[model samples]
Target: MSSSLPSEKALVPFVSVENMMRLVHHIGIETMLAELADFIEADFLRWERFDKTPRVASHSREGVIELMPTSDGEIYSFKYVNGHPKNMAQGLQTVTALGLLAEVSTGYPVLLTEMTLLTALRTAATSAMVARRLAPKGARTMAMIGNGAQAEFQALAMKAVCGIDHVRLFDIDPLATAKAARNLAGKGLTVTSCTSSQAATEGAQIITTCTADKQLATILTDNMIGAGVHINAIGGDCPGKTELHRDILKRADTFVEYPPQTRIEGEIQQMDPDYPVTEFWQVLTGQAEGRRDNSQITLFDSVGFAIEDFSALRYVRSKLDATGLYQELDIIADPDDPRDLFGMLQRAK
Candidate 1:
């Protein structure tokens, strides 16, 4: 660590987990999620402007690590994230991440912050944003099928972005359902803890499945879903991981972020490679149709995308000036003479 404060050029703003939680509390979770949805929706409107691709991932028996990167000609952002469903058994987070935002011109990082919490927030925001467009009109209740780290965020974001006023929670573990219900209480939404996924989906217009299972698991079967409902399948994010059954994909008007990527990592992975799916940005831009009718079963196969993280970085970056919740880290070796590397090292010694 440097004894003296680093110069502005040598520093990058960092938001630690504590600071991140503080910032969320400062903005209020609902308001922050709504703002995040706005940023994500705006980015989707200019979808063609971005340099988009699938996340680069390396999988292991223990878990997977990924790098999700994107840019829109000016600023570039990427998130380094890991997913280990087994980590909870070892007292670890199922997902942890750090993100960076850089100036495209300089290639220098302007912001570097932990993104685990932000990722959950953005994922929920993206789900809610998509729900706003594809969900059945007047969607006031949602069934959250997995009561893990993402359950509370999803419930609240739906309320904030899609006008969902009630959430029914269910998880294979009753404790998980209880935990989610506890977290959701007093949030101005009616919280119900149910015994099973089928029970949770009862009378729900929106169904959000977010179980963090690395293996392919059928959190929702075809029979469990109904007409005029929107499904936000959240946890089928890896090559072999999926939450909804293949039959469900066949019947729903599936929407995805990037087809090339989603085909490999999303719920559509269960289908034939030639399976038809709509690019969600097209719906936002009026280039395609969404929710053809009140009886249409719409599915947002959310594998989580890079642009949402980019939008999240942009949103948090915009708030730093007002929140003052970041630290300047001396991460770059900035010397008086760029070419005199050895001289600078000698001076440091």
Candidate 2:
């Protein structure tokens, strides 16, 4: 009777950054971005379908670590990411991450993949997704305020998603700007390095603030922003971190991913608790409006959300399954007999 039970084994897939990049290259960045946008929009329309929660954040004197988890009744996903701005001074990336995908039905993991690269990809993807709905038509120029690891991804996503062909770049570190410009060369866009934030914002249709500072640094002042400009605020995602001046938020018709979480992490945190801001999902679903007038300023206060990670994980899983680019692992255990869980451990010894 015991022998008739199932084998004490389970299969899961493990993927690496190299494999993930191969998958991305095969599928083409434009196609992947389009599909991810579709998934995000679909998920947004069915907002009630997900079990949402704010991320668990662990703060340190040097930086902050976060775990973002979410489920949709069947699939569960979570990302382990850390943000250490000062680490770059020591030659480490400002942000590093990894994530897991699981089957909720049996609590089994499906994939474990490094997210350092994926995080950059998804953050850029999400920024572009929001910009599509909020930015004014015929927008071509973008001001990228931060020239760190995320700068290239943001620039690529904008080009693929928003038809942006020129990027005006600025960073506190000239070398960082040079690195971004070097990465973006021959990507069909003109990259200009600027010395000041005000210089970068001039004549730009969209402004993206992805600075990697843990302090309350204001990258964009109120007077620097112009009408019909769409601001993608990405860096100010935790308590004590912000990029935009409070007055810029006061004039713009601000949009955020999730209000409850954004109030705590987005640039809106500087404003009152009752500050009126529209959820970008609402704009996607047509439940609310975006960019009422051509001259109106639009702000997307992006604090990398769990749903974006969910969409990213879903896309990666689908690609891996279709291409067989992942390796299977024994991440879960099954006992040959019911109530023999302890015996299985003994058998291994």
Candidate 3:
């Protein structure tokens, strides 16, 4: 029992899937979504202060595994994630993730958590945040084109952040639409299950397409979309996987998280290399415009970004103390003598 024992530096907070779910329930999902949106927006405002890069991806015929990393001088964070559309048919999740946060100076990890849930929250928050700015004013109804695991989160985020009260749902699989409709039954939303994509978009001011296919597919055609609506296309997150018709990209003004990354992974990948696109951060900083007129078509080609995951990790870290939902793991080795690694190990024997 020496007072010289290692301090709390040896322990790192870890949030597991169960703890993350409890934390969400504790904060209330809608409230958490709104707060996460604020955190993401604050980070976007300081976009230039961060080190940003496109996620490094390894693509296979069935799926893609990616590493998304970013740093803000003080803290460093990265998320290990994968997208396997085939997993769903195998009774598995289409996406799964884990994230880590560390100190920039010491290169020591401070937080390790299951990001499968956090990613859903942050992705939905990002979409709702952008919709609040780019969606037509007084927009209350949304068309959710692909009702998968992300459907409820996206719908509630829109309700919580963008004041959406109704969501029209459709999926190639009727079961997904039924699942979404059943889950959203009494969640303060008017949920409608539609048979086709075209039926879902009727009277909806916001259209969100989130299909999970590893190849190019048209979930929304040009004629299916109308003027004065915002399109949040979140499914096309890797090369050769897109959800919109090329003509739609030609007709609408597209905004993205990072141009270089979006051009490689987003719907804009179908466009010319020099095709013009605006980064959403510019809209937040008033350096660029959003939704010029009521008749304008605004498209948020959301391919997800490292900075958004960074913001999510930071947000979860901020809640650890108050919620006490995280566990501390002894992950770092602190020897009596910093340089005597072998000597410290011998003492334990």
Per model, state how many residue pairs clash: 0, 0, 0
Candidate 1 TM-score versus the reference: 0.98
- The regions of model 3 sitting more than 4 angstroms off are 1-7
Write the candidate numbers in order of decreasing TM-score.
3, 1, 2
Superior candidate under lDDT, 2 versus 3: 3
lDDT of 3 by residue, 290-342 (tens): 88999999999999999999999999999999999998887887776678767
Clashing pairs in 3: none
Every candidate's lDDT: 0.93, 0.87, 0.95
Give the Å shift of residue 235 in candidate 1: 0.8
lDDT of 2 by residue, 49-74 (tens): 78888999999999889999998888
Residue pairs in collision within model 1: none
- Per-prediction TM-score, please? 0.98, 0.95, 0.98
lDDT of 2 at 134: 82
